[model samples]
Target: MSEQVFLLPDLGEGLTEAEIVEWRVAVGDTVTVDQSVVEVETAKAVVDVPCPYAGRVVALHGAAGEVRPVGQPLITVAPLDAASSPAGGEPAGHAVYREEERAGSGNVLIGYGTGHGGAGRRRRRPRLAGVDDSTRTAPLPAPTGAGATSAATDPPAVAPSSPGPAALSSPGPAAPARAGDGAALVISPIVRRLAREHGVDLATLAGTGPGGVIRRADVEAALGTAPAPDTARGLSAVPDPSPDNGTALPGAQPQDPTGGDVIVPLTGIRKAIADKLSRSRREIPEVTIWVDVDATGLLETRAAINAARPDQPVGLLALLARICLSGLRRFPQLNARVDTEGQRIVQSAGVHLGIAAQTDRGLVVPVLRDAQRLTTTELAAELAATTAAARAGTLAPARLTGGTFTLNNYGVFGVDGSTPIINHPEAALLGVGRIVDKPWVVDGQLAVRKVTQLSLTFDHRVCDGGVAGGFLRHVADCVEQPALLIATV
Candidate 1:
């Protein structure tokens, strides 16, 4: 028997690695082509890998919840001998069955390629149907046709039989003999994890996944109980007063007397984020500069613009991006990075601004390449696409690379200001804070005016405080007088 090795494919995003969320097969088990053998979760989405060979499983390289790099072998299969081919079966080494070929074949494996001659693709296996010979043991009842008798009134066509040891030990339902054979329960990894953590029985929870597979929300809903009080409180509510304070209850137990609490292992995007951030900090020499801008005029200008085009309104970040691009033109030094290894300064011809967006997978910076050439509307569109992709974890590797500078908008989170970190290889970064209405003396009389804070952090090696200040002042001017951007652009 020849063995075939299956390696993880590049999941369309050019990601170098993925986490093995779950495995549907084990060693010593027989599997057919196109069967879902494993489910892997990349930064942006979860995908199921189908087996490429039909044979008994020989080895598994990784366990569930383990992180594996791309191109690594995920599973191995040993092909059956050509002489042992079932009646009418294609000769051994003949191309494995494909879905298109299953149309004519009567015997088909569930979740695998169709039978001998174009059989319909195997149906997904139901969860409760025991793994071994489930199809044979619990085939779906025959449909009632005009001439057909109901299963209830007629003698059963099939009888229940003892499943082999391998089938009984399998994790999911056994493959069926034909399409529409039986209902298979599908569940997501997140839903499964939630169920396990909450001690909810998988059998009791109805799947909401594709074709009525169980989903995370469905599992949570079925549990009917909220996460532990501590978990919920930690996520949203403010901390309670210390016990030493007068507000302390007399008999309240102290929080987790143990110094250490639960520890969740880092994997997937979170792991990628930690690694990148550490590399940036260690390699880049950062220097931050703050400018308290008189944003009154800028705020008024933005309001007027929004009022004029209510449907296609521009955000403060859009205005900030224009300013940053304009400043880059004025202080070209800020647009250049030090190439120490090359022994030269590498200055980019155009500005590609990286917008730092926070997602469930931590921070991802998607680049708006050539920001200087884009109009406000175009910039907004790009921002929307990048952010949506970031949140979805589907950003291409190129989109996350090649940033000449970065802009972080903390204003949306209600933060007044922050000294943002420079993405390594980028010379500078700009932070925008929330706009507030404050008292200001305009033309001698005190009046309420809008104000905001701008923080710029740069590489001192390439840009001095004077240049940094000048770039910031230009940004302020463009924001304060919105039309200035037209001339600068």
Candidate 2:
């Protein structure tokens, strides 16, 4: 088999590098074309890197927790038919291997990713068995929650070289042991990441998901933070006692050399956030404007809608999103971004609304593509689904970028107000504060009402205070009277 080197393809969005999270196949292990061989954590998301060549793995280029640049050698494979040829040597069985490569993978990376579409068939292409038995498996089991699903659809692709043993020698009730045996029933890489951060052992903890799949909740429960209905027994309430294991956050520097402080290496999501925020601050001359709004009508409208369709109740954020959409329609200046290189203000034809969600990894803003086309209900559903994906750490890299406008609901953390840094390139951000009971004048009379503080941080380069105030006032008007949305519709 001719040895083919697989370089880490450019994981889009102009990303230049990624941190190696784990490797599914070790040296000597066989892999099929499109089979995920590694999981890499980029600035935006955790993604599975598929093998383009179907062959026996001869070399792994990097270890977990290391950063690899784009176009660098990731893995090396000896094509199944090229047994006599070694790397850098003339191919003995080159014709057979090259033919298979051309037919199977088209001589390169498969569209930069096979993550969401998923790899075709994980089953090995049989040679010893002397048959092509690799067939697509049955459907994935029912989803328990956002990150909780079967291994078929979104396999976590746990690495064989876990810090601890893969599984217990003695099995428990949830599923079979995995050490030196089979793969772990983990569907989300975030769950695997969470376990590593908290030093939770997947082999020991019984999963509560479909067919005993370990979900993020299982790891959280094991960490003594998130509650679980049927968490595994015989698990430690705290992180394990490994010297440099999950107990510490990922990317944390090993014990301080000078005993001064534990320095956390800013790499994955944290680095992305820092760079974006710094660029936004340095480039944009920004301004913050806030207003108090009576949200009684918005709350009532939501209640009436929920009463009408309890099965698909609209969320407050969705309603706010609807309001933002309307406000932007009236004052489209807020729905824009600044092009420094081009020296112009670019207004988007459609609103790609970004919703900020805080997960175990950090803050992530998942964008809704062409949100102008979605109704409030559709907006709610999209928000819910993307929020789940964000929480699961499975959000596509595409979903994390290209936002024309941002809606930050920091009220979930009970904050009254914040002048949030604008998502870089995006001209504006609308922050919604906690809804609380406050006294307000209704028809010149004092009354207690559901009131919320709204904060708008926008680029001075995009619009002046007049345009910013007009947008915020329009949103407040919609909050005070949901019927205003009719005109928008």
Candidate 3:
């Protein structure tokens, strides 16, 4: 059998593993070259993985929710004319399968090649042994309409020869499949964890997702969290309270005297946040400095700008972001990354501002590319659109990364000040606290004014406190006297 195997391709941005989100094609189904066979979520974004070979699907390597590292067998497909190919067949390894992943983007992955053909080009993917073939059922042929399975119907499932849920590893250090724990058809690890925490039996609940895979809402519904998800307070709240960039999610507790212990395993974005933050703390010698500023001028300028363009009113974040760009222009040292291993400081040529936003998935810093070149209105529009995309989970992997500096507005959460950790490798992070009415000395008299606290966390390796303090003072001056930014124009 000229069976070919496709591996989970590299997700780039140095990500090593991706959790299988869904299996689009099953065993015995036919797939064309570049056809999306599975959906996988990396630390960066959720992406549909396309198969590189065209043929009959002989096997699927892992079930949804399983995290597979780069270069593992994803699917095995027989030759286009291999009509006699057997279903649920063992992967034929390098003798047949090549692990090239054509993930939509024609751009070839790091270690993977674009298989243009020829048997000599076949690359071998690591195969897992002792795969639970119980889930490997041959697809039942549809009875009518060109033998097609309609969209409303259940996706092709393996015949009774299998009660499914493919395993990631036989007994490796990988997370054990929930099926082994007597769970069924649950594709989301978060849902599984929620069920386990609430003592809810998965077997008794009906799933509402594609192919009967359990969803987070289904589990939440079982737990009576029904108050319209949009209004519910849990993971969806914005203005992340955690000390900037990467930190633990809010509402996490090590111990609860009344509830024994509620432990949420770090997964998905949470895991990414933890990894990035841990790296930042371990390698970077960081320092923090904060200043309280009279933001009345900045806010008044925003109001006047909005009054002129009522249809496109600017936000406080937008004003603060513009001021940040100005400050970075004056002190380019803060807009940089540390090449610790190379023992070098790398300042960015252009400002790719990372906006820290709290999304339903978690806190993601979506970068505004070439931010230094944008007008205040363009910057505001881009920031708003990028943040919306992040929350809506439509942002591409590239948009979520490659930030030179970060702007975190913890003020959205109504906090006064925070000592935020810098995003990993990045030299500095600028945070803004809430703008509130407070007593201020204006014209040498104590008067009520809009005040806000600005905090900056910078890598000591990048610049001394003198530079950091100067950059921060510049930002404060811009806030106190909005005309300072106009002077540059």
TM-score of each: 0.64, 0.74, 0.67
Candidate 3 structure quality by residue, lDDT tens digits, 1-489: 567878888778788887765565668655555555666777776665657776777888876566788888888988755433335332222123233322212223345545566434433221111223354435422232211211113222212122222332232322322433443455333454345434455655665653345565666676653222221112231223322222223332223334444444466677899999998999989999999999899878988998999887677777888888899989999999988678788999999999888764577888999998988888778877777556545577878788999999887666899998888879999988888999999999999999989999999998999999999999999899988887764
Please report the candidate that would top TM-score against the real structure: 2
Worst window of 10 by summed lDDT in candidate 1:
243-252
Candidate 2 clash pair list: 1-82, 1-83, 196-246, 197-246, 199-246
Query: For all the candidates, what are their Cα RMSDs to the real structure?
Result: 13.2, 11.0, 11.8
Better of 1 and 2 by lDDT: 2
User: Which rank order by TM-score, best down to worst?
Assistant: 2, 3, 1
Q: Candidate 2 residues 298-381, lDDT tens each? A: 989988998999888687888999999999999999899988899999999999999887766778888998998998899988
Best-fitting candidate, scored by lDDT: 2
